[model samples]
Target: MKKIKCLGLVWLLASGLTGFAKDYPVSSAKELSALSLKPGDRVLMKAGEWKDQQLKFKGNGVKGRPIVLMAANAGKTVLNGNSTLDIDGSWLVVDGLSFANGRLDSGEVVNFSEKSFSCRLTNTSVIDYNSSDDKVDYTWVSLRGTHNRVDHCLLKGKNHQGVTMVVWLSEKPNYHQIDHNYFGPRPELGRNGGETIRIGTSTWSFHDSFTLVEENIFEHCDGEIEAVSVKSGRNIVRNNLFYECKATLTLRHGNHSEVIGNYFIGNGKPGTGGVRIIGEDHNVRDNYFQDLTGTGNSAAISVMAGLPNPILVSHWQVKNARITDNLILNCKEPFAIAAGYRKDRYLPALNTYFAKNIILSNVSPLKVYDEKVVVNFEDNLIFSTAFSGEKGRGFELRNEQLKKGSSGLFLRPGQADFKPFWESEQIGPGWFLDINKKFTIN
Candidate 1:
């Protein structure tokens, strides 16, 4: 008997059998119900490779301590070759495993099954979980339940037609929290619809998600123009670090969302961008945009227009947006109005506020596609060798130039630990002087 010591259980290493917790074929809904797990209960799956294992992990747990299903060893309980997990329960947690070798047609590597509530998927990983065959589409992780969270996990190598992670909305709002995770490289799909994260689909853009995507790192995610495509209302994207991603965080649909306290560091890379705005009643504030080189639609910040009397699926007109207290540095286009999408009888952006921002050393600070788009631009500082005292291109050109003082402002910006080094004097305007640890892959 080969001894295998594990969390909350012991197992035979040779036979891949466990001592504690139920061991049943994860193939039946009736079998899972038979477990009848409760609060503080634990289940340990058999340690081995599971190919195409489709099962429902069901149980209920109370607050403070949720039920858990853990691997015999971290990263040892491998699920491969189109493997999928459907978690169905309240206050359950899945921890310490890896799901890999997923096929293209594999719908979702892991899904918080419908009706699940207060669940979490933490400290796990999903790598290379994508559709291998062409013309097939699938999401890597689908979050369908409510009040769930995905944290301290690693999701990488998503090269397929669909999004890497998604929050599917329903009759009730999905108040999900996606935090402290690492999103790895996703190569350019050369077409549309390869977003890193999509909050909700356009089919139900009117739904209120109330989701939060914060403290995550998006590394080299060159999938499409939109990195985190928001299609629902009242969502929040904050405290995230987007490093050299050749895309923008687009508010693609709905309204009343906020993107704040995020760091977008392009390091002078081509195609790298900051944020794109759509719809109305949104707030994009207290963010840092540095070294972005995208010119037109991929500008550091692009506000989009919409068609007249648009439907929920269509892009809505930008209205009553508050874009303030941001720091934009060394970008090609810091501000763009009606960016890159113009056709038919379009409605222009209106009643926007751009205030108290500090912009520096951009090739072109403002890009205006629709001159009819009006904004209340006030109290903004521009410190550049280029244009000065110009009210034409979205800037008012206030008095005195701001300088990047004698600090390691550009020190090793291409490295993984790269961040703009700001002196104590230049520490205001929502920019931080320290290394943003959320910028790394770890």
Candidate 2:
């Protein structure tokens, strides 16, 4: 009897798996629409062209078992000619698809609806997907849900008015993670408003999205001033490479965020900027900025002054910033304290700390216009630059020289080797354990 009960339990488990886990091979939009999708459903697209098909995927799967929608083959299935998908539910995964040679006629290419949660789009590519109208604005992917992820996707040739992707934060924190994606070749829009990724808009900029953008390559993003204009608070931009882009990663609107471990290789380009810092309590550390030629407002690191406490909606005052452990090399105007400041009675940057930073290359490192501004500069090493004779009210200036004719990459004394190179300080973030890497691209 016990042996029969064991065999009966095995049959029941097999019956349960067959009852719930189903693979639906869809060809037409009507066929996909006709199905009543439940949890643990796998909707697989056949290997063919899906043109002009605006399909909407809707299902609410639980946490451990997500509803999946993938192509039959990884890069074989193509979505062309104004083809798009609207994800409307939670815990859904769309993967292994490609959108090529398409022009969206009206709306977004992929839109996560406002009610969705924990959905993901992974291992996909969208190439040359634009709008039919140049004047009309449309986002490639507009993420409106919380805890959604877009990872390992290749997005290229966005030559339109709006952003490539956006994490729109409304009532709660989105907590989205955009990792290991390739943002390639966004040519210069003749006008403005061509950001690659915008976290939030102006009215919702004060909210905390807490988004994490990591290990992505932003190449030739020549749209406007901000390649990734971070407008929301508590967002993290880390371990990304900005290669020869005409814009910088700007913390334009939010506060209490951090930009760390990013590599900015300008390759002697004229307008390639590194990091533009605005707002308050931002931690800019452990990054490498080199070979840039951007000046003035487009410097390697620009610290904007604040508007006087006025009666309007304006930019925030730069306060309580901790800028440390950076290696700035061979860039024109690497550090600017009161960047883009005029003489017309503005609020100064206050309570900012600049320490443990090493600046090499020519002179003219710091650019401070306001004399009454509050900044603390200490323990920073300089090769051929000068910014501080006095840092604070009674503080002493401590800009240590690298001893002219010193050699190697700051490893040996007066033994210079090749061009600028840095062995950065190793820091283990609490997110990762026991992994020792200097600016490790996460």
lDDT of 2 at 289: 82
Model 2 misplaced regions, further than 4 Å: 1-19, 309-313, 343-345, 385-442
- Give candidate 2's total backbone clashes: 7
- Which ranges of candidate 1 are over 4 A from the true structure? 1-34, 389-442
Report the C-alpha displacement of residue 82, candidate 1, in angstroms.
Answer: 2.1
Compare the candidates by lDDT and give the number of the best one: 2
Enumerate residue pairs that collide in model 2: 406-414, 406-415, 407-414, 407-415, 407-416, 408-415, 408-416
Per-residue lDDT for 210-322 in model 2, tens only?
99998777788988878998888999999887878889898888888999988787878779898877788999998878777887667888777777763223666788888
Write down the lDDT of every candidate, Cα atoms only: 0.77, 0.77
Candidate 1, 1-442: lDDT as tens digits: 2333363243233222332334333333344456777566676665678776675788777676577877756667778876677888898988777787767465777899878999998878888876656447888889998999998777878887888899998978999999877788899998998899999988778889999998787889999999999999999999887889999999998789999988888987789999898888999998988888887668888888777877667778889999998888788889888876577536888899998777876355777788787778887767666765455555655445443323323222122433432111121111112323423211
**Candidate 2 C-alpha RMSD relative to the actual structure:** 6.8
User: How far does residue 38 in candidate 2 sit from its true spot (Å)?
Assistant: 2.4
